[model samples]
Target chain A: MPAEHAGPDGPGTARGFVHHACLYGSDEEFLAMAVPFVHAGLAAGEPVLAATTPANIELLRAALGDDAHALDTAETAYFGRRPVERVSAFLRYHDRRARPGGRLRMIAEPVWSGRSARQTAEWKRMESGLNLLLAGLPLWMICPYDTRTVPPDVAEAACATHPARLDGERVTPCAAYRDPAHYTASVPPPDLPPPPSAALAPPTADLPAVRRFARARGAAAGLTGERLALAVLAVHEAADHLLTADGAHVTLSAWEEPGALVYDLWRPGPLGAPVPALAGYAPPGAARGGEDGLWLARRLSESLDVRSRDDGTRITLRVAGPGDAEAL
Target chain B: MAHTDGARHRGGTSGTGGTAGTVHVGDLRPGDHACALYASDEERASILRGFLLGGLDAKHKILYLAGADGPRGPGELLEQCRFTGPPEVPAGQLEVLGPAELSPRQGELDPAALLGSLRAAVDRSRSEGYRALRITGDLCTALCDGRDVSRLLRYEALLAAEFGSGEALAVCQCDTRRCDPAALDAFASAHPRSVEVDPLIRTAELVVVRTFDPPGLRIEGVVDTASHRHLRDALQSVASVRGDVRLEMSRVEFLDLAGLRLLMTFARARAARHCTVELAGVPPHLLHVITLIGWDRTPGLRLGAAHAC
Candidate 1:
C-alpha cells in the first residue's frame, strides 16, 4: 500500500514526467527530499517552482543560498483559494514557463494543517485531477505531504492520487494510485443529517414569504452577520428555484448541527438522471466554462449535497462554523 | 367605470403585505384588494379574525357579510376571533350582517346596486369618524346559490376599482372546496393579491420558463446534477435569441456544481455573441457564491442588486 510499478521505463534520452508524493515526518526530512529534487532539476537545466508555506520557502531559500534565486517560489495560500482556480493558475504558469521540448519541475504542498474539511476535499480532487490535467505536459510534480501535519485520511488520499512516492529519495511506484476518473467518482462527501426545523411550504406566488421564512429561521438559529446573510441567501436561492417551477409544492427547512448551519430544500418529482452541467466536476474542455452555479455553491458553502429520488429532490447546504475546522 | 382616476394605484398596492408575514388588514390602503381562498372552516375563521381584528385596532369601520346558511352567524364568528378590546359592534363601528342585507332585493342579485351600496358604505365610514371601511365577505353563499360567475367577476372588478380610489379595503373569501378551479382563477384574477390557506405541495424537478418583455427565463425547483443539462439546454436556447438575456434565478432553491457551470457556460457563450447576460433576484448566498467563484467578473455578465425578498 505504501509503494509498488506505475509504467514501463522510457528511453534514457527522453525526459520522464513523474508525479510523486513525498511523505515526511520532520522539516529535515522534507528538505532531504526537496533539496535533491531542486538540485536535480537545476542540474537538468529545467525550470523549478516551489509552492509551499512561506516558512518552508524561506528555509529552502536559506539552504539554497545563491542558487535559491534560480528557483521560482510562490506562496501556496495564493493557490488555496479553490482547487479549480489553483489548477488553472498552475496550468498558466506551466505553459508560460515550460521550455519547448524540455522538462518543467514543480514542488507543491497545497494542503496545510488547518484547512476546512471542504477545502481538503477540494484539494484531494485537485490532486486526482492533476493526473489528467498534466498528462501530456513535460512536467514532474512533487506533491509534499507532511505525515505529522496532515490527517491520516488526507495522507491516504495523497497516496491514491499520485502514481509514485519518494521516501528519502527512494522513488517507487504507488500501487494504491487509482485512475483519476475512478478516484474522483468513488470519493463522495458523507450524507448530512436532516434539518431539524419543520419545512416552510410557500406557494410559487409567495416567494417573498418563503424568503422571509428562511431569513427569520436562519436568524433564530444564531446565524448572524455575513454568515446569517449567506445562510438566508442560500435558502432563498434554493426556494426560488422550487417555488417558481411548475411543481405543485416545495418545502424549505433550516437547522444548526454542532459546527455547521444546514438548509434542506425538498421538492417532489423526479429530476431524471444526474446532469453533467451540475456535477461540478471539471469535464473535458471544462477550462472554457460550465458548472458556474455548482462552483459558486461549493465555494460559498462549506459543503453541498444533492440527493434526487423518483419522487423528489432534496438539496442540503452546509456552512462550516469556527468549530468545524477539521480539514474537509 | 366612473372611477377611472383610481387606476393610478392599479399596480401600487398589488403585492404589498405587512412585515413578519402577517396580513395587516388595517394597514392596507384604499384600492387594495386581497383574496383569501380557504380549504377548511378553521382557516376561513382564522383569516376573518385576523382581518377584523386588524381593522378594529385601526379604528376602521368593519363590515362582515356572512353566508346565509352558515352554522355560526357573523356576531358569533366575531366573538370567536377573541378580540382583545371591548366589543365595538353595539357602538356602530363594527357591523356583522348576512348577504341578504346587501342584495338589492330579497333573494336577488344586483351588481350595480351592490356597487352603489359599497360606495355609500365608504362615504358613510369617512363621514362617521372612521379611518376607512374594511369589508370581508363570504362569497361562497353567492357562488353556491348559482349566481352568474361573470356577474360575480364584474362585481369583484368594480369592488377592486372602488377600493383603488383609496377609500376602502376588501377581503373576499372563497371556499376552495366549493369553487371550481376556473371560477377560482376568475375571482383571483380580479383581485390584486391572493392568499391560499392550504400549504403548498412540493413538486419534483425544476421548471424553467422563458419570459418575454425584458426577455428572461424563470427557473424553479432544485438545480442539481440531475437537472443541470436541461438548464444548459434552456439557457442555450435562450442564448440563441438576440440581445441581452436575463436569468431570473430568485425561484431556484438548490444550485449544485453542475448548475453553476451551466450558468457560467451560458454567460460566456452570450459574451462571445456580444450579448450581455443579466441575473435578477439572485439571493444573497448566490451572490456570495458568485463572488467566491469570481463569476461576477465574467465579461458581459451583470448581476442585479440582490433582492432581500
Candidate 2:
C-alpha cells in the first residue's frame, strides 16, 4: 500500500474522499442525483461545492430555488482549465471547508469541449489522482458525465476513475473503478505530429543556448508576448532538471504548430523508473520529492507531457496562443 | 585550458622562480591578463586596492565590472574596492560596466562577443587619450553563473592576446572562498600570469560573491545539483546578522528545484529571525517567471530591482 495513509484510512473506502462518477442520459437524471446530494449536505450543515457547465448550473439552481443558494458553486469555465489548475481550485475549496474528522460533499463536472486527445488523457489522469490527494479527508464527491456532451469513451474513463457509481437513488461499488496508480499508469502521453528532422538541435547543456533556441523557434511559430515567454520558461524548467540530475546529453527538437510552440527535450540517459503517474499533477509548492520541478513546468505552460524511453526521458512542453492567466 | 606551466602561488612566497610562484599586484604590467585567487574578502580587497590605485596613479582609463549579478546601473565601483580614484573618475576616465555590456546579444553568451566588446573598450580608451585601459572584475562569477567554461577559457586566451597589444590590462579575480575548485584550476592556466592563493572553503559548490558595501549576496553558478547541506551550513556560519538579506541572481544560469528550495529554506529561516529576504538583480522577466510560479510571494520574501550601485 505504498507505506502512506493506506489500508483503512486510504481511498476506495468509506473513510475519506469518497468519489462517485455519475452517468446520466438527460437533465432529469442529473438533477435527480445532484439535487438530493446538495440538499443532504445542507441539511447536515456540511460544506457542499458544485462546479459544472453553465447550463447545468442554471438547471440545478432553477430546480432547487432558494435551497440551491446554500450550495457554493462556480461555472466549469472558471472552475476547470488545465488539470493541475483545476485540482488546485478544488484543494483550496477543501482546505477552507474541511474540519477535523468531518465530512463534506462535492459535485464536479469537468469541461470536455474543445479538448485535444492529449488534454483529455491528462484530465482523466487528474480525476484519478484526486483519490490520492484527498485520501485522508472525508470527501463525498459526485462527478457527473452528461451523455449529451461527453463522449462514451470519456464517460467510461471517468467511471474507471471513481470508486463508486451513483444511479437514480442507489450508490453501488463500481466494478470498473481501478486504483489511481494502476489506472493512471495505463494512460498514454500525447501523440502530436513529430518535428521535422532538421529541427532537431544537437545536444548541449547551456541554458542560454536552450533559451535562445526556444525563443527563435517560438518566434518563428508566431508565438509572442506571454505565450512565447511561457514556452521558453517551460523549456528552461525541463532542461534545468536534466542539467541538475543527469549527465545532460540532451537534444532539443523544436517545431511550430499553428498558434503554439512545441518543444521536445530528449536526454540520452535513463530516468531509472517510469515517470510517476502523479508527477506534475500536484499544485505548485505542494509537490512531492521527485515531482517538484515538473510541478512548476506543467503549471507555467499549457502542458508538460513526460514519457520515459529506452534511451532517455523525452519531455514535451506546449504553449498555445493568447492564454489567460487563470491557472493561479 | 591547456595543461601548461605558468607562475602559480606557493605559500607565503612571491617570485618568478618556478611554475608555482606568486607575483605582486604592483608588478602587473601593461598587456598583462592576470588571474588571482584570494582566500578571504580582506585579501581580495587588498589585491583590488593595489591594482586600482596603480591604475588611477598611472593615469590609465579604468573599466570596473561588478560580478555577473550586479549593480546593473553602476555606482558600486571603487567604493567597494576600498580605494580612491583620480578626479578623472568623475571626468569619464573611469567607466563601470555590468555583464550585459560584455555581450550585446540578449540570451546567447558568446565569448567572442565579450572579446570584441573588451577590444572595443580598449580602442575607446586609447582614442580618449589614456595611456592604457585597466580592466578588473570578478571574471569567475561568469563561470559560476554557468557561462560555457571551455568557451570562457578560449575567451581568456583571446583576452591575453588582446592585452598583449599593449593597450589594455586586466586582472580577472576569483574569490577562492566562493569559487568551484575545478573552475579555479582552469582560471590558473587560462592566463599567462596566475596568482594562486589558498581557499578558505575548499568544497565551494557555487560562487557566492558577497559585497558588504551594497549589502547583498551575488549568486552566480551552475547551482543545479548543488549540495543543499553545504550551502545552508555555510550560510548559517557566514550570513550577516544585521539588515535584510538581499540576493542578487542576475548571473545565475539555471537553478534546479533543490537549489531553489535551498534558497527559500535559507530565506525562511532568516525570516523566522524577523529578517526579510529580498531578491535583488533578478531580471524583470525572470522575476515575472518566479511570480508566475508563486515563489515571489513566499513568506518573508520580496522582489527587488538591481541596486543603482
Candidate 3:
C-alpha cells in the first residue's frame, strides 16, 4: 500500500521550497540530478552542500570539477545518525552558509543499507518533516535514493515524502507527496518484541527504585559509559513525565534487541492529547512541543515512540550501541 | 535511607523544610544552643553569615570561637566573613577568641572551665546592655584538639545546658569532612536544635543548597517531576544575584528534562541581564544532553570548569 497520498504534480512541486526526491539507478543518473543542482547554486552564489554517501559525492565532484571546491559534503551515515540532532546539524550548516536573502542547496541521501524496515521508514519521516521545518528558509534540497540498494517499497517512500520527483528526465511533482504531519501520524511505531515475563519489573511510583531497576536493566543490556547514561536518563525522564501527568505508577519492560536496548513504559489511563507530530524535533529556543522531558528523551535515546493503546499509553525508548552510527 | 545529617556525601535531595527536624540559623533565639554539622567551610560560612548577621543586625554581642585546627584563625576568618548586610560589625560588640583561650590552650579540655567562661560572657553581655549574647564555636578541631572523645561530648552537653534558658545562644560547628561519624552524631544529639540554612529545596529525591561567595546553588540527588517545582523555585531565588551564579552539581545523580529546561530558561533570562549561570562539575552525561540540544550554547550559560574548584 502507498505510505502517503499519490496524485499528479501541483504547486507543491514549485520552485519555492524546492524539495525533490532524486531517484537514480546508476552513478551517471545521480550526477545528472546532482551536478546541475550544485552548479546552479554555485552560479547563483548560494551555499551548496552534499550530504550523501562517499561514492556519490565522488561522482558529483568528478562531474562538477573545479566548481566542487565551493561545496560542502558530509557522510550521510554520520550526518543523519540521530533524527533530532540531524535537524540541528542541517540547520547549523545552513545558518553558517547563510547570506542576505540568499539560499542553500543540499544533496541529502538517507543511509538506507543495514537499516531495519522501521528505521528506513523513520528516515523517510525525517525527509518529509524537513519540508515543513525548512520551508521558510531559501533552501533547495534534493534527497537522492539508490533504487538498486533499497527495497521497492523503501524507494517508494521518497515519492510520498518529497514534493517533487526526478526519477529520470525532469523534476516533476511527486504524485504521492502527503503532508509531513499526515505522513508522520500514519507511520507505524517500530516493532518491539514482548519482553520475557522475567524481564518485566513490577509497576511502582517509587522513583528511586524505578531508577535503580532501570539503570540495572540498561547495564545488563550491555550499554555502558555514555550510552548507558543516555539510556538511564531517557528512562528516568519518560517515567518521571508519566508520573507527573497521571500521578500514577508506571510499569517498565526492558530487553536487548540486537545492537540496541529497548524499554517499554506502560502507564494507566489515556495520555492527555495526541502526541504532536513534531514533538522533540524543536530546537532549544524554538516553540516547544509536548512535555519537556519526553521531548528531551526523544533526543537523548535512539528513538522514542508514544503509542496510545491497551487502554493506556506505552512509550518505547531505544538506545543504540556505541560506534553504531547507522543505528544511532 | 538513614536520615543521617552531616555525612551527606552521597547525593540526596534538599527540601524547603530544612534537614529533618533542624531549625534555620535565622530562627534560633536566645536560650537555644544548636549543633550544626557542616560539610565544608563554604557550608559553615552560609550558616555562620546568617547566625552572626542576625546577632549584628540586632546589636547583640557576638563571640566567635574559631577552631585551633581550622585552616584560618579566629581573627582572619572574621575579617573574611563578609556578613553581606551590615557594612561593619561594631568593634565593641564583636570579639574573636580562638581555642587558645577556651580550655587553657593546653592539657585536656576542661568542660567546667569552658562553661564558666561561656557563663561569664553571657553575664557580661547582659551587663553591657546588649539584648542577647551569641556564641558560635567552630569545634571541628580548633577547640577539640587535645580533648578525648568523651570529654568532647561532655563539653558539648555542658555548653548546651549552661547556655540553655539564658540570654546567650550557641551554634557549635562540626565539619563533617573532618569529624568522625560517631562524634558527629554525638555532637548533633547534644543540642536541642541543629542549624539549617532554610533549604531552597529539600525532597526525598533531590536537595538544593544555596551558596555564597560564588553565589549559586549546590544541587544533589535526582530531579524528577516531584521536585521540578522546587528546582525552579531554587533557581528563581538566586536569579537576581549579580555576577555568575555557579551551580555545583557533582553530587547530582540525575536531572529530568524539565529541570534541565528550567536551567536553560534561567540561563537565557540571565544572559539578557549580562549575568551568567555557570555550571560547575556538571555530570558528563547531562553535559552531553545539554550540548546535544544546544542548551549549552546559551550566551550566559558556561558549562564545565566555569569555577571547577
Candidate 4:
C-alpha cells in the first residue's frame, strides 16, 4: 500500500533529516520514533537524552532490551542510593565513556500528584534546579505521558528556551513525522488502595476507597503497567525505523486543516475567514480533498508568520531561509 | 483570661464579671479582694494570719511573695502556717500561679497556664469559704511574655478582684559614731511612727538597730518579733478606725523585709485625714534606736509601752 499520501520527499531517505526529523502523533507514536534515534546515537558513538516519567521509563527499558542504557529518577534513587544530580551529568557521562558501545540517556519525570507537602517541595526544588542547570542542553524533553504534571511555570520556561511543537498535547522539538507505532492500545489492571498505618491498632476500613482514587488518577496519567507496556512496544516500533539499512525516514501527512494557531489576531485563511479551527482544519467529511490538505498545511504555516491586526493579540510573521546570514 | 474591675480596662476574651472595691481581710464583701505583697517576715506572718483567719473578707484577695522554696526569713513563719512550696501544692490551690520551674525561659511565663491557675484558685477558695486567694512570687517573675513587674502586677490585679499591694524593704544600721546619711534618708523617707518607751522607742511597730545618729532623729530599740496574732491586732486597730493618720516605717528593721516599707507607705497614704495616730508593737531595737537618735521629740509620735525585760 502507498500508505495514504507519499509525503513531500517520500519515506526511507535522510535528505531533509535534521530539518523535519521530529516525531509526533501520540505519546506512543513519539516513543516509536524516539527509540530508533536513541539506538542510532548509541551505535554512532553519540549520546542521547530523554526527559520523561517513571512509567514511561519502565516501558522504554523493557523495549530497548538489556543493551540499552536506561535511567529514571525512581530507579536511580532506589539503586544508586543517591539523589539524581544534574541532568547534564548524563550527557557528560556519555561524552566521557571509554567504551564505544556506551551511550548516555536521561529522563526527567514529573510524578507529583497527591504527595506529601515535604515531597512536593523537594520535587519542585529538584525540577527547578535541573531546568535552570541544563537550560542550554540539546537534551530532548520527552514528556511522553503528559505535560500537566510538570508545573505550568516549568513548561513555559523550557518552551521559551527551546523550539517546541505542541499538537493537542503531542509536543515535540519541531514539526514531526508519524510512525506506524503511533497508534497502540492496552487494557488496564484492577485498582488497589493504600495500606494501613498501624497493623496492631485496627484494620483500615477506608483502604479500598483510597486505592480506588489512586488507581483512577494513575490511569488518567497513563501510568498503568498495561499502558506503559504499550508505550514500550511503540518504542520498539521507532527502533525498527532507526535500525533499518539507511535512515528509515517517515513523513507526516499534511494536516487536512491549517496549522494550529495559538490564538493570535489573524484573519482571512486564504479564502479569508478566521481559521475555523485552531489547528486550522476543515471539519472531517468536508468537500475539500487532496488540495485541501496541502492548502491547509501551507495556510497554517503562513498564518503562523502573519502580522495580526490588533495590538495585544498581534502576531507578526518572519521569513528566513538557509544560506541567508541575515534574519527577518 | 484576665478580667478587669475598672471600666477603663477591657476584659479578656474569657473574663468573668467582677467589680472594684477595697478589700478588708475579714469583711468577705462581694467584689472586695486583697493584693498582698509581702517583703518581710512580719508582713508575711501578718498576711498569713489576716487572710487565712478570715481577716480580709470585704474583698476577693491574693497573696504575692518571693522565693517559693521553704520560706526564707519571714517566709519561714508562713511555712510553719501550712504555706506549701510550689511543688507540693496542686495548681488549683494557687491563683495566677507561676513558679521558677513552670518556665524555662526567664521573664516569659505562660499567660494561659497562669490565668487558668488563677481561675482554678478562685473557684477553690470560694468552695472552701475563704475570703481571698494567694499567689506567691514577685511581680518580676518570668511570665508568658517578658512582662515587667508593674505590668504583671497590673495583670494580676485585672485577673483577681482584690490584690495585696506591698513593697520590698531595705535594712540599715546606724548610730552617732557611724551615721549613714543614705540609710537615715531611707528611714526618714519611711517616716515611721514615733513612739516613746521608758527606755525603748518603737518606730512603725518594727525593731530598730541604730548604727548612726541624725541631728534631730532620736535612735531607739524596736519590737519586730511580735506573733502573727499580735501583728494582726495592730493592723485591725488602725484599719477599724477611719482617719488619715500615716504610719512611718523607714526606721524599722525585720528578719523579712519584703513589702514592709510598701505596707507602711500604703497604710499612710490610704488613711483618711484628721484621725488619731497610735504606734503599736514597736520592736525593742527600733525603740532603742529611736531614743539614741533623739527622735522622741519629733512630731507625729505618741509614747507607748516598753517590753518587760
On TM-score, the candidate that comes out on top is 3
Tens digits of per-residue lDDT, candidate 1, A1-328, equal 4443222221112555568898888889889877877777877788889999898898888887677989998899886466656665577677679887888778898855788775677578668878776676778888989888889999999889998887756677777999886786566545454644544555333444555666676666655554655555555545544444454455666677788767676776664333221244332244633343344444456666655546776667776654544532
For each candidate, what is chain B's TM-score?
0.53, 0.54, 0.62, 0.33
Query: Higher-TM-score candidate among 1 and 4?
Result: 1
Weakest lDDT window of 10 consecutive positions for candidate 1 chain B: B1-10
Mind giving the per-residue lDDT tens digits that candidate 1 earns over B1-309?
Answer: 011111111112222122113133434555568777666565565566667666777788887766665324546766656555535553677776666666747765566777787778778888998988888777544753453488778778788767877668888888767886667767766666764221111225465655443566766555644566678777765677778989877655555544666787788888898999888877665676676555677777899877564
| Residues B1-309 of candidate 2: C-alpha lDDT, one tens digit per residue | 010111222232332212254545666668777777666665576676677667778888888765565445334555565554523344777787776776566654566877787878888988989899988777576655553367658767778877887778888887766656676667766766654322222232354544343344655434544345555554664365576777776645444456666666667777787888787766444565666555676677877784221
Q: Which interface RMSD does candidate 1 score? A: 13.3
DockQ of 4: 0.00
Order by TM-score, highest first: 3, 2, 1, 4
Candidate order by decreasing lDDT: 3, 2, 1, 4
Q: Candidate 2, B114: how far from true, in Å?
A: 40
Off by over 4 Å in 1: A1-18, A26-28, A39-48, A81-104, A112-126, A129-139, A151-157, A168-170, A180-188, A195-252, A265-271, A274-290, A305-315, A320-328, B1-291, B295-309
lDDT of 3 by residue, B232-269 (tens): 88999888887888888876667767678888888889
Which candidate would rank higher by TM-score, 3 or 4? 3
What are the RMSDs of all candidates, in order?
18.0, 16.0, 8.9, 34.6
Model 4 over residues A211-251: C-alpha lDDT tens digits? 23322332333333322222222222221211221322221
Which window of ten consecutive residues has the lowest lDDT sum in model 4 chain A? A180-189
Query: DockQ, per-model, please?
Result: 0.10, 0.09, 0.29, 0.00
Candidate 3 runs further than 4 Å off: A1-16, A167-169, A181-187, A190-193, A202-210, A219-227, A240-249, A276-278, A286-288, A321-328, B1-116, B119-134, B137-198, B306-309
- The deviation in Å at residue B156 for candidate 1 is 36
